[model samples]
Target: MAPLVWLITGCSSGFGAQLVHSAVARGDKVIETGRNAATKLKHLEGTGAAIVDLDVSLPEADVKRIVDEAVKIYGKIDVLVNNAGYGINDDYRKLFNVNVFGALSVTRAVLPYMRAQQSGTIAFVGSMYAWWAPALLSVYGAAKGALRAIAESLAAEVAPFNIRAIDFEPGFFKTPLTDMAKIAQYAPTAQPVDAYAGHRAAMGGLAQALIGNERGDVKKGVELMVDVIRGEGSASGRKIPQRLPIGEDAVRVVEGTCKNALKVIDVWRDDVVGTTDRDGFEGEKDYEAIVKGPDAQV
Candidate 1:
């Protein structure tokens, strides 16, 4: 196969950085991008990967220009990894900008090229929070949830053109993104109320503990991601999962969420199933789920 070209966002640290290393190690051409790419990503100086400065939160035209420059490096882009995160500040607006809209803008820029080539993969680095977020960070989870929804619908729309949009929800991983100390340095000072102080403190303590002792390994998780993208190693002989949960904890949480949803649906099916246009439509007796199998996705 010809060398695949990868344009990845958020290469400054953590999973994004690890992904650049992983892809380059596999001999794929990589355009590693992030803010201050020449400085933050200096560690990759001699790795043969092109360092491209890309601030995903920038204007759409700026993003398009940077992506266009990246595409010129390899003449085409085979994969896009939308892994940028809220850097420095946890302001809710910036969180949505970097985590949600940033990816959308970048994806829109590359989509034309992918459609023309009739092949590509777009991976959105989401979080377990998409399923169930912890306290004090609901906004972050909301952004991830939105990204997941985009991927799910975009996959169906683009499949006919042989492009894939995937959303990867990883549990707490040993990445700078999960570093509570760094987050504290940038987090805004709290305006506390007497009644909520205890609750806020508890959530803060939980975050510090969980982030400090994150369970997922950065390199291993990124390697698995690369394998799936390349259709090698563990991903061989298997179709790439459109919504992949990165670690055991992520899988467990995702599974629990699904089971809980199914339980609610099963409990409410009879009450809610026949209410809407049941009489106007064909007799609902035979409206049972037509697809019945353990592996059924929908």
Candidate 2:
């Protein structure tokens, strides 16, 4: 088999850096991109992975340029990982611009090539917080949630083209991205509100406590991703999960949220059902049959 070509963003550190190393170790060609490729990714020299300076938050022309460079190096991209993202303290707009729009822009730029090739995988590195919105990270969670929705919808849209989209939702892990000092530098002060003063202070304390305390192993997570893409290792003999939740905490949060949602839905079933049209017309007596007809395709 021919070696797979991978284009990954945000290779400066965290999951992106780990993925680049893992892919290269497995003998796959990688086009590793970061905002400051020269300094941020200087350690990757002589690793056989091509480094490109790419800030996903940039405009369409910049995104196109990066994609063009990757294709020029490897001929065709077999996989595209939309992993460039960061959290801002109080700037929801800034966070969304980078986390949501940034990823979307990169995906948009690569779709044409993936569609033409008729074989490729796109993975979005979202967060477990997307499903379980924790306090203080509401905007960050929202951005990830949007990415999750995009991946799900894109999966269905591109299935016919033999292109797959996967959303990897990971919990906290040990990485420079979660460093308290680094985070504090970027964290903006909350707007002073007497009612939220205590809550704000508690959130600040929580952020500090979580630094260096994350339990998920970065290496293992990257390995799992590599396996899924190759159809071997942990993902062998199993269908690729549309949304693969990583880490113990991530699994628990996803499962617990699902269970809680089901319970709430059941409790409110009567009220929810009552909202539907109750009028029984003589012409349409078989309402249930009509409603349960053939599934619609988009």
Report lDDT (Cα) of residue 9, candidate 2.
92
Model 1 residue runs over 4 Å out of place are: 87-90, 193-195, 276-298
Which runs in model 2 stand beyond 4 Å of their true positions?
189-191, 278-298
What is the per-residue lDDT of model 2 for residues 203-257, given as tens digits with 9 covering 90 to 100? 8788778887888999999899889888878687776667888999999999999
What lDDT is obtained when candidate 1 is compared to the true structure? 0.86
lDDT of 1 by residue, 1-298 (tens): 6789999999888998899889988989999998988788898878799999999999999999989878888899999999998743547898899899999999999999999999999999998889987766788889999988898878878989999878889997987766767777777665656786787799878876887688899999999999888889988877776688999999999999999999999999988876765455765355454333322232
Distance from true position, residue 292, model 1, in Å? Answer: 12
Q: Please give the distance, in angstroms, between residue 172's alpha carbon in candidate 1 and its true position after superposition.
A: 1.4
lDDT (C-alpha) at residue 140 in model 1 = 83
Error of 1 at 50 (Å): 0.5
Candidate 1 Cα deviation (angstroms), residue 170: 0.7
